[model samples]
Target: MEIILVPAFADNYLYVLRDPASGKVAAVDPGDAAPLMAELERRGWGLDLILLTHHHNDHTGGVAALVERYAPLVVGAGHDSHRLPPLGRAVADGDRVAFGGTSAEVIATPGHTLGHIAYWFAQDEALFCADTLFALGCGRLFEGTPGQMWESLLRLRALPDATRVCCAHEYTLSNARFAVTVDPDNAALRARAEEIAARRARHEPTVPTLLGVEKATNPFLRADDPGVAAAVGLVGSSPDRVFAELRARKDRF
Candidate 1:
């Protein structure tokens, strides 16, 4: 499976997962059709499916347009069917769907939204985590509880070390800034922030970082570290409290 990242609205990303051998491609979160359609036309790839992780406008806004043009099958979280654009398959956790030759495992990751889900393909070492997990930070809990978000994050963090994290937005630079503040003595975070800044200066992307690397630098995934525990006042707090405090600190940051 070849993963193609397409930048969409502001900082959002639209992913195209393709089976080059079979000449079939599936788009994940086509927020708008203009840019994605052009990209498809340029590559001469046929879009066969739409994999939506949530109901947010920036993630599902162009679903109707794309479906109208390509008539691809739309897949969305079963719990968010009411909100998601006309969907063909409503999946839940543990459900598996096939793309030309690749398979995507639906992971129920609710935090950014109650019904938010992520697509994982171990064979390709990639994940289409729409707004749930980022480079150095995690998404804000819009509707779910802190405990729910924490557990959800833990689930993703438990994935294999080689998993390539392809998040939904260009938040690496901003997240690195906040992460350094959250853990000032983290030398790795310091170095990465500068590198991410340079990438932004060159107008380059800073994504597809390995999950193992995020474990070393991302504050949201370091809730057990002494620095992160202290920063979030989690020394004697429950996971829910820690998550809430950590989120609050990021909000202020």
Candidate 2:
């Protein structure tokens, strides 16, 4: 499987996945179809599937246009179908969806939204996690509790270290700034922040971050770590409480 990054409305990212063996194509969160269409035309590919992570407008805004153009099979969380564009296949946590040569496991990740979910292609080690997890940050809690978001992050953190975290935003620079404020003494984080700065300076995408790097440097994924907990003044507290504090501080940052 090959992944292509397409920039959408102000900082949002839309991913296009291709299965080499079958020449099958799938798009994740097409916020704007014009760019995606242009890319597809450039590559001479036809869309076959559309995987939606949530019901947010920025993510689903292009779905209607793409569907009208390619008539692709649209998949989304069953619980969120009422709000999302019509889903050809409504799935829930743990459900398997077959692509060209491999399949993906739908992992329920409800933090950014109550019905948000991520698609994990084990064979490709790719995780299309829109808004749930970012490069050096996590999504804002719009419709879920701290505990819920914490548990959701835990599940993502448990994936293989080499997993490519295909998150849907270009917020790494700002996230790195906030991360250093909490994990000030982390050498790995400082180094990663510098790299992110450099990448953004050159106007390059700094996402599709490795899960291992995120575990080591992303403060949101390290709320349970003693250093992160201590930095937030919640050393002895549960990870959820620490997460809540970290999230609150980030919101205000």
Choose the strongest candidate by lDDT. Answer: 2
**Any idea what lDDT model 2 has?**
0.95
TM-score of each: 0.97, 0.99
Global lDDT of each model?
A: 0.87, 0.95
lDDT of 1 by residue, 33-143 (tens): 888999999988768999999988998888898888899999998878999897798899999989877888999998889999999998889988988999888998889
Ten consecutive residues with minimal summed lDDT in candidate 1?
Answer: 231-240
**Relative to the unseen true structure, what is the C-alpha lDDT of residue 241 in candidate 2, on a scale of 0 to 100?**
97
Candidate 2's C-alpha runs over 4 A off are none
Off by over 4 Å in 1: none
lDDT of 2 by residue, 1-253 (tens): 9999999888999999999999899999998899999999999999999999999999999999999989999999998889999999999999999999999999999888999999999999999999999999999999999999999999999999999999999999999999999999999999999999999999999989999999999999999999999998887999999999999999999
